[model samples]
Target: MHNPALDFAVNKENKTITIKREFAAERPLVWDAYTKSELLDQWWAPKPWKARTKSMDFREGGRWLYAMVGPAGEEHWAVADYQTIVKHQQFIGVDAFTDADGNINSAMPRSTWDVAFVDKGPQTLVECLISYDDLAQLETIIQMGFREGITMAMEGLDELLVSIKK
Candidate 1:
């Protein structure tokens, strides 16, 4: 598949969503794009919805708080609480919709994200496994257009990766 193509799958029974894509960049670069907020801000959100990091602590038990700003200047905040981080290999975290103060929204679904970066010579394979609290929660977010937004974000990442490779 092309770098812009993603293998997106959902498992309602397992309460999980999986997204796989390959980038024409080294594993280290891909890892950095994920771990560093500076790089993340470049491509984390879909076009016209920029990601702005408020704070990032890249460590186990730490948090990365950010907002997805709309073209009209509206903002939606979220927080990722890192659970495990293995440099250049894998990272696991929980992401939840939150207020600007980083308080998790109990009314919304929370998802655990398990991300893996596999070295493939000049390229890297990125896999993201997102597990929700339940099947209903998974459906809820999917119905809310998570798949389309995230697919667009991944494509944005592909464009960034291509530019950085130049």
Candidate 2:
């Protein structure tokens, strides 16, 4: 697989995690990979952890429910509640840990995500801004290895895009 062009930063002042990445695919293709469940399943999680969507509706007020199954067969459920969608351009949503039955887990940190897909001729640049409720919550996730996990997941996305391009 080709190396991923990705940048991950945590802003202390804004209390947010921002990830910037460039993919060889066009904006529409990148957008589809994000909004379409089947496409997301191919690259959403890190290796040895497959993503399975329980249900998805790609629109404002809609939700994408999924689970990340580990090599040991452990499943971690999560849900993304969409707040705004701008077709192949951008989308904003709130993500939270949840149960298989779609019940939120209050003990987990929740994050608001703003994802933008910028057209760059034959390539697309994806910027993701993730905000936590507070510094404590932010620290919690960072300590949990969020950065490494997301970096690995984005590399998976890079691989998926390369396969599609071929």
TM-scores for every predicted model? 0.96, 0.95
Off by over 4 Å in 1: 1-3
Cα lDDT listed for each candidate: 0.92, 0.91
> Model 2 — TM-score against the truth?
0.95
1-166 in candidate 1: lDDT tens per residue? 3455789999988999999989888999999889899989999999989999999999999999999999999999999999999999999999999999999999999999999999999889999999998888899999989989998998888888888874
lDDT score of model 1?
A: 0.92
Error of 1 at 8 (Å): 0.6
Error of 2 at 59 (Å): 0.8
User: Tens-digit lDDT track for model 2 on 1-166?
Assistant: 3235678899978889999988888889999999999999988988889999999998999999999999999999999999999999999999999999889999999999999999988888899999998888899999988988888888898889888874
RMSD of each: 1.2, 1.8
Q: How many angstroms is residue 30 displaced in model 1 relative to the true structure, after the best TM-score fit?
A: 0.5
